[model samples]
Target: MSARSLASPQSAGEQKKKLADSLIKKFNKKFNGPLNNPHLSSIIVAEVGKLLQKAKISPGDLEQVEAKISREAVSESSAVLRNEDVRLRKIKAEMSSKGGLPAALLSKEDRKILPKELKKTIASPKKKPAARVSVNMLENTVRARNAQLDKQKAKHTSVFSSLGMVGPATPDSDAGNILVGAKSLPLDQAVDPWSVLIMHDVKKYEDERKQREEQKRLQREQWKRELDDQVKINERKKKEAAMEEVKYAEEEQDQLRVADIQEKKKKEAKMMINTKLKEERAKTVAELQEQKRRQLEEQKEEEKSEVRRMEAEIARAERRQQRKREEEAERAKRLQEENKEQRKMREEERKKKHRMDLEYAASQARMLDDLERRRLEALGKIKEKMKTIEVMGDTLGHSILEKEEEDERRAEMWRQAYEKKQLKVCFFRVCWCRGACNVCVEAVRDRGGEMEKVN
Candidate 1:
């Protein structure tokens, strides 16, 4: 029996070797684990082995049970380990990628319980909120926005303030917090965010705004300049038109004045010509009247001269007729005286002849005377007586008687002769005187009658 029992201990050693091999295979198959740190794998395998030993089963049973529990534990541990390994690698990767802990890693408990060193390793640093604006910069922006809003609001204060409600406050107070409390307000009463932003960024926004405003102002100024220039041009044109009208009026007036002057000159010329013609006509009439007067005066003078010549001729004719009449009367007287002288001489001759004859006869008769003687006695006685007587008577008677007779006879003869001669002479003288005187008287009468007729 001693020999046999010693042989049985060898057989038990072989069975333990088999059980260990089966457990390793089950563990490997159940858990598909990754290759990890060798030290952790070794510690886990040793702990599994000690639990198996504590159960004190047979080597075969222990192998089976150990394999089952090891398989289960290894399967669950593989998932947990893989999860834990992946978490640790992510933590390390996060720490390496950002050079610090992820913000999500901090927990409420970790925040409360972490030591300073771990907190330093796990906590992420925070960036400060944007720095609060400077008081002066905020004041300046607010002032600028207020001033711009005021300018925009000038037309209607209520409407402009409503529209500009989002704008910054004035520089005097509360410039930065002006829009901070506006969110809880009603929609109508709220400040606009866009408007606030615009107000905050006023310097940049207003620069572009000011440029546009300047452009608009420049455009308005240019338009005003153009309008003013047009107005000036219109005024100038109106002035020129007015001046032209005045000039035309003045020219018309000048023309009228010239025409009037010309008409006046023409009238004056006509009047002068008419006056001259009238004066000439009057002068001609005066000359004609003066010529007629001179002609009349000359005719009168001629008539007067003719009358004086005729009167002188008539006086001379009268004187010549008177002288002829005186001469004819003297001739007639001389003829009568010559005829009377001749007659007286003839008468004396005849008487002397008769006496001579008587004386002769008486002488022859003386013888006869004796017879007468007887008678003579008587006679003688007578004779003696006679003688004596005769002587005485003779002486006385004879002388007386003879003387008486002779005287008578002689006286008669003388008377007869004288008477005859006187008668003849007287008759002749009368006849001549009658004829001549009649002719002369008739001529004188006719001449006187003619003179009376002429007168």
Candidate 2:
């Protein structure tokens, strides 16, 4: 039982190792090998150079170090090229021996040999220092001046403490005189002009250092971003490969299913063909028998139909004769009815004509009566006007010639009015009469002209 337990663990480890090896092989094949970013190596070399410069290494030492590094790199590259196959075998053997240890559990040298992107994930990233607060150059100058002043004051105090006499009442040197004057002024104005240059140089150096630090920070961030991008690209490629594999598997399954369905369809088609052939044959025999039977039945039916056709023809002839007789009798009756309707219509037309003639006569009589009455009334009105004119002439003592002229004028007006009235009556009559002759229109026009002349 102890042996079995030990063997089981070994077997499980072997299985895991096999699984890991297969997975690694698949990953290598899918990725077409590990990443080889030339830029990353160049950046690392540049960073090393920057650190060496920061260390203030001598030019001779730098040259020697560079030469050694170059020789090593060339030798290492050649060795790697020469031992690639051996290296692969060794790696396989190691993996087999290790029994499924992960890449992270490998040694530091092994981790260094891994891809840069993978190394980033296997190792913890260094935490960047917080950025330093920037001080204004004027503020720094003021602070430096204050510190120098404080140190000078402390020295003076110490010197005075050691002396038996009190401090000097006034300064004698030019610097002492300037300091005495500066002491009376503000701190900003009291700044030593000589120190400005030193402060400026120090500020310049600080700015350069900050700038270099910022540049290094930016480069690091950019490198990290590029690494992240590479990782993402690898992940996307892996996903795409997995999807393609699934698609290929599904396509293979579909091809197999299609083949199976085609085979089944071919088998079913053969069965259906055989069944159709038998059915067709049986149907042909049955159809031949039915055809003979239908032919005999058709012959008997044709004979009966012939007899029935003769009887139907005789009956149709008799029906046609009877229909013709009935049609003739009905047509005669209809003609007699139409003649009666025509006679009644003629009588109605004649009566309508008589009524119309009477209505026309009555209208004509009414028109004539209205014309006569208007004429009589006009004449009476003219006579009354004439009599009034005659009376006026007599009352005003008019002469016979004036009265005669007045009488002539009155007669002319009466004649014009009468002619205008006659013309209007003629125009109305012409309008009332349908299709009035042109002669009547011309006469009325002539009367209108004459009346207009008189007016």
Candidate 3:
């Protein structure tokens, strides 16, 4: 071991010794600790915790030193025992050969039996039994618990049975045993499984059959009652409907006679209004045609005046061109050799200027070509834009048509609603007229009766 580990209080070896000593001490004190010490498990755990705390170690640290202390303890005990055995054997040999202090040594039987027993104890392996709960014991405990519950249930059931009330219960094997025990019959007969099963099946079938018959009888009676009720209702509804139809027909005929007379008067008025409107439309058309003829004559006279002005302008332009050529020829003859040297210099400048002009003309041609190319590209983009605009216009027109159709549909719906309202008004008017006619008829009948009595 390193000096540092040996010297340190919290080292592995020291921690193991502390843990083992603490365990041994707890065991020595009747397996009790500072607490009530009810069990060995708690004591061992407490000792382990206390030693680990003192050594500043963890359970993981204990793993390395777990077997060390136990192994050392065993070896220490075996060495002490071996030394004692050698001393004893030497003393026995001395007693045999020299007869020195024979009384101080053990007798032959004690010596042989002690060594043989010790050898046997040392040679035999120590068994570390695995701790487990016994399955048979657990099963017995469960069975006893079940029996207790069954007894309590039986007691409660017996009390309720006397009062003719029973709680719900599920059948199990134990229930049959209980029934057999309660019944006063021979054990063999009462415990017969087949007899129990047959009785259960018979009762089930009888109950089910009784329920089915009761249900079917109730359903047949309900159906017959419903059929009778429906027939009576149909007869009553038919009588009410026929009376209403007859009353409605009488009222409709009277209204139709009144509507016919009123319609004839309205048609005569509409025809007179339509003739007036047609006459007014024809007068406006004739006025518009006269104004158009006057405007066409004015436009023809203005065109003739413009043509005359254009012809005068063409004659003036031709005369100006003739004068310009005459002026150029006279100026050239007068200034021809007035500065011959200067003229030569002027000629050289003229040649350079002409070359420059030629170069400028070539550049202008290239620029014109570039402009033409740009114009072509622009024309293509304009065509594309036109196509897009056309499509957009078509879509806009379609949307407008759809909107107009929707507006028309809404207007038609409104017209239908107005017509329905008018029909309702007419129906109410007809009902009012019917009520007045009934009152008048009753009065007339009373007058006729009075006249007969007077006569």
Candidate 4:
């Protein structure tokens, strides 16, 4: 039966009452009929009531059971729908591989209609491709649907214009009038039913598409701004790094230059010190050599003076010995002359004695007296000689004193002469000397007590 016919109020109520009355009449007739068994009928009626009561109880229990079963069935059906959704997606993949229609348009049971629709769409020349009803198509459909909306908007604008307001009517402006008109007219009054449905879906689809497009544009702008900021940051870092490198290089170069200058200065200072030291050492060596030469000359002069003094002493001793020998020879000659005189006198006396005794005796007496006088004279002479010797000794002492004084005067003269000779020699040596010899000469002249001459 048609669902509408079964649900009609008058038919549903009348059918329920007639079924109830028929069941009651069947019970009464069965008891009052030819069977006419009262006890049996009563038992049957009681059994029927009991059966009704049982039936009612059974119905109530069945209703409770059915509700529980229905809840379980509904949960199982939902599970089945979820499983079917998965199966449908898999089938969609297979069908898409075979270039069939999209599976999104069909429910689990309705998917069977998809093949028939695809067949019809492909076989009938009048049938459009499903792609014609896609987002792009829906956009176009929305644009066409807006034509009728535009007419309604124009009508609303006219109503507003009658009130003397400016421009067209807005959505917030009296949609009450449009709502009343929309309610009074059937849904398909102004447009084909299918077209009205399509237009409505198209409008909703276009609005969602616009909102998604705007979101994407905003995201693209945000990404672009981030990229620009990163580029600027990288550029700044590169510049800073390059500057730091340059600064470090400059510092290194400066340090190298300073080191080079210091090295050069050190070398110069060392060279100057060495040169000064060498010059001072040479001067000291020259002075030492000059001093040694002067000392050697003094030593030679001292040796010569010692030799001269020794020779003078030896000559003075030899002269003293020769003077003593001459004195002794003179004394021996005087004694020999005296001895010859005395012997001649004695021989003459003997000859006189023999010639005349008496006469001779008187003569002899006179001669004896003369002889005695001569002897006395000789003794006085001897005494006078002794006195002369004493006088000579005194004279010799005076001579020795005179000689010593002369020697002292001579020695002083020699010393003065020797010093003069030394001065002359030193002058000559100085005039002839070369190089540093002038300094040696100056020193010698100072030592010789001739500094005034040098000045």
lDDT of 1: 0.43
Q: For candidate 4, lDDT tens digit of each residue in 1-455? A: 12244334676557544634554455435323322335444543444444334322332232232223223322332343344345545554554465443222233343332333332322232311121234344456557755755677666634323222244445644433333323233323443334556777679756865875675466445433433453454455445435544553564466456546756865886687578658866976896699679868966875686577767667665675586467557746654664465456445644543443566346535744663464345335434533653564455444445544654564465346546765333332222121123344454555765432331
Tens-digit per-residue lDDT, 1-455, candidate 2: 12233234456656444633553343223221222224334433453445334323333343333333333333333333334334434544565465433443455434433344444443433332322222344466556655765666665652222112134532321234333322244334444643665666568767866975675566445544543454455455445445544553564466456546756865885687578658856975886698679758966885686587976677576785687589669967976896687688667856865886687557645744663464345335434533653464353332334434644564465346546665233332222121133333454566664211110
Top model number, TM-score: 4
Residue range 1-455, candidate 1, lDDT tens digits: 12233234456656545645554454443332322334435544664466445424532233334334433433443343344344444444554465444222433432322223333322322221221333345556656866765565564343312222344544442423544433344335645444565566656645755775575466445433433453454455445435544553564466456546756865886687578658866976896699679858966875686577777667666675686567557746654565465456445544544554455335323522432342223213212322332243233332334434644564465346545654212111222122232332343343344211110
- Using alpha carbons, what is the TM-score of model 4? 0.27
Worst 10 residues of 3 by lDDT: 424-433
Candidate 3 local lDDT, 1-455, one digit each (tens): 22234346556676567646765564434212212224444445545655445535542234223223322322333343344445555544554465333121334332332322232322332332222223334455556745764676676543223212234433433433334324344323334333455566557656855875675466445433433453454455445435544543464455456546756865875687578658856976896698679758966875676577777667676675687578668756654654465567657856865886687557645744663464345335434533653564455444445544654564465346535653212111222122232332333353453211110
Give Cα distance to truth, residue 344, candidate 1, Å.
99
Estimate every model's Cα lDDT from 0 to 1.
Answer: 0.43, 0.46, 0.45, 0.45
What's the residue-level lDDT of 327 in candidate 1?
57
> How high a TM-score does candidate 1 get?
0.23
Model 3 spans > 4 angstroms off: 1-191, 258-455
Those runs of model 1 whose alpha carbons end farther than 4 Å from true positions after fitting are 1-212, 242-246, 249-253, 302-455
In candidate 1, the residue pairs with backbone N, CA or C atoms under 3 Å apart (3 or more residues apart, or in different chains) clash, namely 370-373, 373-376, 376-379, 376-380, 379-383, 380-384, 382-386, 383-387, 385-389, 386-390
For candidate 3, the TM-score is: 0.17
- Candidate 3 clash pair list: none
